[model samples]
Target: MSNIINREIKEIIAYGTSTNPKISLSEDQAFNVLLLQYYCFKESDISKVWYEILSMITDGKDDGGIDAIYFDEEDSKIIILQNKYSNAIQVQDVVNEINKIIATMNDFKEAHTGSYNKKTKRLLQESLDRLTDENEGNVEILFSSLATIDIHKIKSKLLGIEDRVAYITVLNKGNIEEMIEKLQLQHEVVAEDSLYIDNTKNVLKYASDQHKGIFVNVSSESISRLYNKYNQKGLFNLNIRRYIRNKNVDDGIKNTLDNNRDEFWFLNNGLTIACTDFVEDGNKIRLYNFSIVNGGQTTNLIGEYKGKNRDEFYIPCKIVSSVDEVSSQDTMKFFNTIAEATNSQKPIQPKDLKSNSPEMRSLQTLLLKHRVFLEIKRGEKTAKDINIKIKNDELAQLIFSFVNQKPGTSRSNKNSLFNNNKFYKQIFFKRYSSEVEKTEFLLDLIELNDRYNTLQKKFKAELSDQFNLEQANIFNNGKFVLFALFGLSYRIINEDVEISSLKSNSSLIEDDDFIYGPFISNYKEDDIEQKLKDLITFFVNILDEEYTNQYENKKVTSVSNFFKTDKKYINDILKTTVNKLGRTYLYKEFLEYGQIFKRK
Candidate 1:
């Protein structure tokens, strides 16, 4: 193998060993993981865990020459992968593998009793059954070899088999190398110091105090080439809804480029670019540090297009930039404003607009030290060092649901949490005196939320009693409320805190050492989960008592309705429980509940 491929293989092995040391695999198995990770599942929303990927391997005896098989639920497709971990693979080997898969698919379709392993048959049968006409089930055959092979030759050999498969992708060493190169580019920002814009058409220029722009018709082929080179490298960083794939829209764009070239300029909305500056030469214009803030879908379609008449058409283009020599606070804000105003094809939420705000960027920087990634852009790449990818809206929801103690609003008014200036500032505008302390406090909330979700899933799957099942339903619906209650329980245990103290701005809440140090930080994951389960049991009983009281007075109808209404009544119940039972007695009750569940 070449040095680069060898290095990649070694890295994959190292990562697998590091991430999951209990399970081990050979180099061939590791290579399969690498290929599937980057090629089949990277773009699609599939599990990227090493152990999960390895679990899909059915490559033992009677495997039918297929290495790994996965059902991509996001795209509703079946992926059949065969990897060749070698530097010199024969063309016949590729053909034999494809033929084997074709036979296997036939077996699946006919329910034939084949010699394939039971695991492979079961997986393939189930996956094939999901691909009906209503959902447009697709089967993707990926034949990847470490050696350089003639893909066109292999494709030509499979000519009449298009009816059996949706599409076949054959990748050789060169293709893998190209994929690796693009993967590397996803980690870094790529800015073109100078790009030539076609100036053959009428170039309308406008100049303001600090803004400069041009309206022109740039060739689609040029845009396509630039997109091909810089698409993964921050080409659409400024785009609010970056490159959502709609098959119908994509086919329309490609069809027009292929057949209706003359009407392309009139049919589609032009691209809107934000740049640092631009200069016009004789027949070309040069743009620096530019990003496509609009027309992300059109640009992506054209970039990956295979139409022959791609170069025969031009797209309407509008490029805007600032004249400031140095990037200032005002200049960056200007760029953000332009990005917000130009995106109109897809509905832009208020949170989407705040992705580039100073507060968001500051929080992102603060969290990076703790290995938490704040994904602001729609499809931005997560850096290599990131341990977690929290979307901006997710953070907003978390803060509102847990810290602010408004679980109902967190669920129903999520957009308002970002849309209302006061709410947005309340959640994100805090300047942490100590970043590490603040991060740990927030991380604990995330941990609690995760444990709550896991227990909910267990209740859904394992519990059988009608009352418990009804409670589980309430648990699922009022998850955010339960999340807030968990935090409230912790605060109550630490001190005689009131309900209003759960607000994010409360000094008692901000004092992480005082609030989180003694109890939550002292438990292992198993212990935390047990404590959370017990807390939920105790809270459920309290909620029942409060609901019965209110129902007798004709104030509330049901338990779920009791949890769903305004949080004030819920807080009053919690306060009454803490005051009636006393913090010490309630703490003992939590422990007793834990012991009961443990015994069960």
Candidate 2:
């Protein structure tokens, strides 16, 4: 083993044996801490990373060898993690553990129903519901160990045992060392001898003291070598869109490479490479800090065409190098711009461009004035001035739930919602048109939502059984109560004496002037404290009525199903109640219930 690998192994061992109050010998706790540290090393946002880790902890012994699980809802992939923190583990033991996991997943429903913890059972069932034959290839089993083992030999033995799985990988000391090296590389701006290209057959397209552009007619074999050397670590790191494995595109590339090598350049937009510096000597061009900002498909295809018709093709490439004295931030910005520009031919998700957008940057700056950190880029945790940072993904979800008024859509399709056009065209684009207005609007909305979440938890603990409803309703549909509170605020501000005016202005609830200027300005903390309980009581009464109605009409067998089936009716009732009662009557009713469920 290399010294780096030995060092990492030692670190893991030391952490495992530490007597810190937070550390524990339990397998689940140890694995959670270990994986948390691993992802932390990968530079994931600490808050979001901890959220994912906590979500996966099953909290019991009968976890069926599954320490933690993550479902990449976007890719429709399930990542099953198993960690063994030991100095030495036999190959057979590892193989047996993997086989056991495969069997358990194969019979997921049965295994989960038997003796597993409630949390793991629910997670397993939800995961099984998401998996179908079409996405069976998305399952990834990762086995991690502190020991050094021959991965190739183990993979050979485990071949074909679960052919349906996407793939399996073993994370040992070598893999940990590679991860550490990648992390280190992320901090450096300059690289030495980063790329190798031939100079004999290629021509210099443009040359200057500060910039150089070269056009190369390179063989697929050489391109494959370049990809093997750098692509895995961070060659296309700046590209916003990740490479999706498309069989059709791969086949087309291979066909074109085999049939028409000369026409490949015309038919395809050749690769665009950026480098900090390079030097040409004899037949070789050595590049520094080189990254491919475009042509990910072509690079991946070249790697795939490794053994078949590999040498029969040559593709064109455009290599651009710069030696100008630029700051690291400017260089990163330049690369990000190139990445966004080059990927125009492919479909880009909203999140792909949102980080660098002018609106987001303006909002980020505005948020900083309030001591709130807004993270525009995913997995970025560089904001050091605040205790809580709101990630772009989380902000998007909040916008979807609050502004778009589709909390159900946000709940079911959390991953897909950010990429959808409606989120951009209907909500984000409209709200961000006026930066100051939208900034205040979002700040108020987040504050209100946070308080609502806290009150919902308290309600569940204190009154869930008394209300005679499932605890799930308190967790899932609590957003409806928040929406009702917004409507109530409008009623209070308008002082229309009749609730009918609220119906016309209900759409105006999302309006910034209506929410921040009118509603927030008029209400005090004590008013909110009283109104929150009233809102909860209002929702409870509506749910109780719906339960009785459903039970009498035989429309549902369980009271929980009432929330699922009659959500529209519940919303309509809440709206109509606010409309009929007006602000004065509602305040009177709140005072009546105020003395009963008085705030602690």
Candidate 3:
């Protein structure tokens, strides 16, 4: 395991150094970027581009213990990366770094001043400002190194102010080995155990020519004991998903255990274990190289239970094994099938079912031709060097918002978009014949959506005084609607369409047979930012004006809720926008932009 960890570290170092050799980074500097990509970002693979990785490095003169800082928008957490890529990491050094970071946070909160570098100061202040109770502000300190240290020893030295952060996770050698194992999709069994089968009770044994199984009941405590001893050692590696800790579900499990122990077996799903082989000698059954393929949640909760009656309940158990006649590949397939099938009925999201659909595969293949990886399945590994990766669900929502102009439905009922065949086909399937044409069209919309999201994040972070209250509300809450309107507004600018005609017909917004295409702009890459900003400002101001008018006339009460209704958008906002339009940014700046459907 230690050797494997060393190899992994060397690979990361090599990756970092070779990504941009011109930068001439030291081993420590390269390791900082490596940690930023792998540990801080929590991405098993390093998919970030070189420049983005370079921007995360803040380890230099006047730096405050933080080697790199990344804002994780998904969890609203500020991840501070502390890199110590050496085999001689000491607990004292780890403790000292934590104290320094705590002091830095205090200094930032009090005076918002620090001796850190300019980037560090700005990022730290921004992170600190966002650390409000309302926002559920969390700070995660990632102390990464090649060496393992006593975690309790380091935590014992911390003061009470450590509560200000969420958790300080140490990424050391053992963790590296685990990560590598997951990447390789191979879990090595580190231990094995046996169960005392009740000879007095009926133990039904089933056997095919090549496969075998046994069905019996075992004390819940026995299963819990197995989890307690080997849970951390990949005892549940074959389970479809890890034990997701849910307080409510856990409480219910405990309630059954404490108050209704007799009915536990009837209420809970039983465990399914898969092993290489099992030997039944009299009353003892020894499972060799086995893992629980299902019921991981119950196993974990039962393991955590400390009630005196934990041993009083019995749980149904099914054990499956294969003889020497079965090939290793067949055994693995059988185990994986059992894992997936058992968990498939557990409140699966609609998108999970569509991951392997024809539409998804088609889009994925089309995107791959352009050197882009479409992650149709969650946690699917793509090429490490692939710079562009898009999630299928996100792309679907983007198209629904921008092309279909159903931003409300896009947000409020995204699952339906995948569940409903008509909507799913409209978004994911292209009407065009040429794959190149389809890829280009989707790529253009993707680029526009990316720019829109970036601008929204910037506006939120900067809180520019330029946007009034109403405008800010619309910009923040009406993101999908705003993107839809931006596209419609661009069309109005370029096509020179009469707003009166659009308002009178209304089919453009209401029709189901409408075929939408990509928006082709004449502006250069460097000019896009300013143009997008100006266009956003202009559209947001109009949206605000219409919203305020509706509010003053008692037509609507809540601006946010108003934006959520598609009918309200069409009846009031769209009408007002078109009625008020004139020669705007489109005519003044560039000559033309057009919607493209085919190559010609």
The best candidate by TM-score is: 2
Local distance difference test, per candidate?
Answer: 0.66, 0.58, 0.67
Q: How close is every model to the real structure, measured as TM-score? A: 0.51, 0.59, 0.56
**Global local distance difference test of model 1:** 0.66
How many steric clashes between backbone atoms does each model show? Answer: 0, 1, 0
lDDT of 1 at 34: 75
- Could you give candidate 1's per-residue lDDT for residues 502-548 as a string of tens digits? 43223343334333232345453456566666667677666656655
lDDT of 3 at 105: 72
Query: Residue 398 of candidate 1: its Cα lDDT?
Result: 75
Instruction: Provide C-alpha RMSD values for all models, in order.
Output: 13.7, 9.1, 10.4
Error of 2 at 38 (Å): 2.8
Candidate 3 lDDT by residue in tens digits, 1-600 = 366655555666667667557546666776776666555454546644444456556788777888887766544568888878687989888887887888777777676454777667755654554433433437777787877777657666654645677556677766665755654574555246887654635588899877789997767767777877886577877885656444345668888988898898798878888888887766667888788888888898788665566446778888888867466687778778877877665655689899887767777777776667888887677956564777887888777776677776775566778899999888876743265445555777677767767776665534345785457656656777777776565455545344667767544665534334445433434666666677667667788888777766757544545565567766777776665563466434322222221222
Better of 1 and 2 by TM-score: 2
Residue clash pairs of candidate 1: none
- For model 1, give the 10-residue run with minimal summed lDDT: 591-600
